[model samples]
Target: MVNQAEQIDVPCADAIMRLLERYGFDTIFSIPGVHTVDFYRTFPERGFRHVTPRHEQGAAFMAYGYAFATGRPACCMLITGPGLLNAGTGIAEAYSDSLPMLVLTASNQRAELGVGRGCLHETKSQHAVEQQIAGFSHLVLDTANVAEVLHRSISLFLTARPRPAIIEIPRDLLAAPTRVTLETASMFHPPAPAPEAAKMAADLVAGATRAIAILGGGCRRSADAVLELIERLGIIAVTTNAGKGVVPEDHPLSLGSSLPFEPVRTLLEEADVVLAIGTELGETDLLYTCKPYQIPGKLIRIDIDPHQLTMNFHPSLAILSDAGLAAKEICKHLSASVSGADRADREKIVRDSRAKLVGEWSAEAPKHKAILDVLAGSLDRDALICADSTQLAYTGNHYYPSKTAGAWLFPNGYGTLGSAMPAAIGAKIGCPSRQVVAIVGDGSFLYTLEELATAVENRVGIPIVLWNNRSYGEIKDAMNAGGIPTIGVDLYTPDFVAVARGFGCQAILVESLSQFGAELGKALSRDVPTLLQIDADGPSFAELAN
Candidate 1:
């Protein structure tokens, strides 16, 4: 017979550890500080493997990368004040992108509140920082309510449209003895099906002449449903940059990414009906301009978050539901409602668009011809490519198409400049055998360049392709659109080849299309990690956009 007393007598921290273990979190990444002493001490005792990061920001990014690769949220602990503050950049990235994360921090004791008795790692306002993040909905500030808060917060973190949640542990409470409960209800809640809305969506699709489907990151969680919806409706589907791999780009219906492409912009404006699945269609996706093509035609927007349903452009029908379940329900009704004429027209459009894009790539100019060619030839079906927030992201979306599912990750929601390097590191670690590449601009590369040390030390040898434009190209593009002189946008960069070598990685520099193939091949063949710095013509966006 099992002893009931033995099962219920776990320590508070031990109980928390068991909860994490139940959730399949075996690794905890953090930078130790005075406030988090208990966490550091207890984490090891509770059988959690800890990774001590060189910097708090690096630790958070590492955790973010781990979550991205594993499709599971990772926990990060930071001390009060500076520790938490240092992690702000990466936290903002997770917040913007709806990445699942549990940010644990030590808080000043209640007894020391405003007494002017100096406290270590004290902050006047810690919660103030949490609110600054765009999608930080779940937070826990009281340690007395740790189990209750953990139960609720963990549920929210794993629920649909996952985002980062902050759990502040009081300094005194870490040592306080209390009864630890091991019982935790399952936090996973699948998005419920919306049969009625799906039927309505089907009817709307049946009536359209020219139709397009815009898939978002939320929809990517249900790639099968997205693919089924596409196959049934036979619509020309284009994903937002973040939603790139929801449907394979090689599919006839897949119109690649809709990130600031003039052709896509024109198509969206002319379409009769647009089905937006699980995407908020943020300002960045729309090139920060939503004048005429915001909602091109009859807009049918389905999202789990109700706040995302409203439109700067008009939305005809708004359905608030889970993306996957909604797509599944819509697929059920699509077969009967979709007519032969609609299917024929959609197929014809996709075929024509594919031919046009292919022809353009074949006849590309001296500048873009090389980068595109290398990407086209080297990118494997199973390879995962991560792009930073730069013109490189737009180019990758336009040119590179993944063969398998979850083969591409980008910093879309947060649009953080330095995300690709660390994210690529995480993705490589997540799938060590598969090829993982970080495509970054000079400015973005500089943001977390120090992470190269992390990569070298950890023996994570992923290829990094530097688009050496020597300028903040995205800002320059934005400035040109606004008719402003490019000030504070231009940048000076070091020789990435030398930088890569200094970090103990093989380095190559390619100036023309001719050198691309050789350099890329060499980089991939190397046993150790390599960096291929392509000093392509400045401002490729202007040429590519045209």
Candidate 2:
């Protein structure tokens, strides 16, 4: 393989590396298979620091975590068929949460089509799995014009509302030579401002007595704009789990996260007008379900993608614009609409929300309270936390608070299980100096338990805090709600302490509240990777709901 710096017309793999360099992707996480020979060979020449994951899924999740931490898409590569199959969960997580990522895979030659000859690692269709994920993906197939496809694919992947996209290069395409022009810059463009759209939003806020802003994934990208908008309009703001830390939770007008909480529902019901910014208000964020067209107030929605405007809830006004730019413009127009008294009232609301949250955490039982307290104390103010799906997602989003934008990352869109471990590994790799933590539930942890080895191999050293409740807590709650007994959701698992030790990382199992502080302190202070497993003392969601 020719070096990336040497401007030689080469195969699709070489061209892809050139494109990656142009996009400033210096690190790549992958689990190479026989199908990706050319990509593996070209990585070193391209000056990419490649981390070989133990599983393809681990690679994908790691890329997702890295993107969340650094606000830049990380590249992932896998072989076709089984490789792509294993990577499905990570790709889905990236898709659902709008994480920017490039997934490159090698497919069998076009000549090998449908010949029940059954080639090694062959699938019925290379692109089928991606199609299943299409609702959340921006996929592209590269059958011809590899360079052009690569350019366009990268462009779409970087656009506002960025999501995972695939470029399937066939075996023959990698072996064939092609004319290549060195790209001086990435083909992708930065999102532009939406001033006109922002003014309209400002007008809607001006006419309302009680306006509430619901921040989602898109708002995280423009935290400064959101903060400015809140300051200007003096409106109460609440974040969905994915949108946590878009603005400081401790900020006067910020209501923290509102998922799985009765207070948030009450607040929404009381508002005269609801401004949903950058979030789709999806099913999971709305407690697994919500009544359509039943919101008590006018709904004004703003998002970078037009498709998200009317989902779940109808909107009085919908605007397609970049979140940050829209927020900035709205702030600019809100100067005349907000009075001094209104600002004071908004501040009071924020105070009340904070006081309420503080009260809840303080009143929690010893075990759950210990987990929350240890996490808050151990995590650096600027450290990044990547939470997995299910109970961990709910608990972390509600209890933990982050100080900066992109500091709290999680899989919110698809609500896929088992994202925390791999994502934490990726985030650690992306920002090696910052302390990264993954909060995961037992059910979610089982989905990607093998990635623990990848973390050890790469020395990514992220502390994984497993909230071991010994059951699929969320599903149990649902079953109980429907008057069914908890059956399939409960599982007896191996001690996570032993599991972490077997994987050669520091491990601790804390069952008592008294042991919480020591275990957390040791885990966070360690130079090597650590896993702190805590046995949560509480009724399963089933018991609580029943």
RMSD, every candidate, angstroms: 4.1, 4.2
Q: lDDT tens string, model 2, 135-176?
A: 333223342476666666667655667887787777777757
> Tens-digit lDDT track for model 1 on 222-322?
78877888887778888876687788888867887644555666678888899988777877675523323555589998877777888555588888777
Instruction: Extract clashing residue pairs from model 2.
Output: none
Full-model lDDT for every candidate: 0.71, 0.74
Stretches of candidate 1 exceeding 4 Å from the true structure: 1-12, 45-47, 113-118, 134-144, 184-187, 288-296, 335-342, 354-366, 476-490, 511-515, 518-528, 537-546
Off by over 4 Å in 2: 1-7, 134-144, 187-195, 288-294, 353-366, 390-392, 537-546
Determine which window of 10 residues in candidate 1 has minimal summed lDDT: 358-367
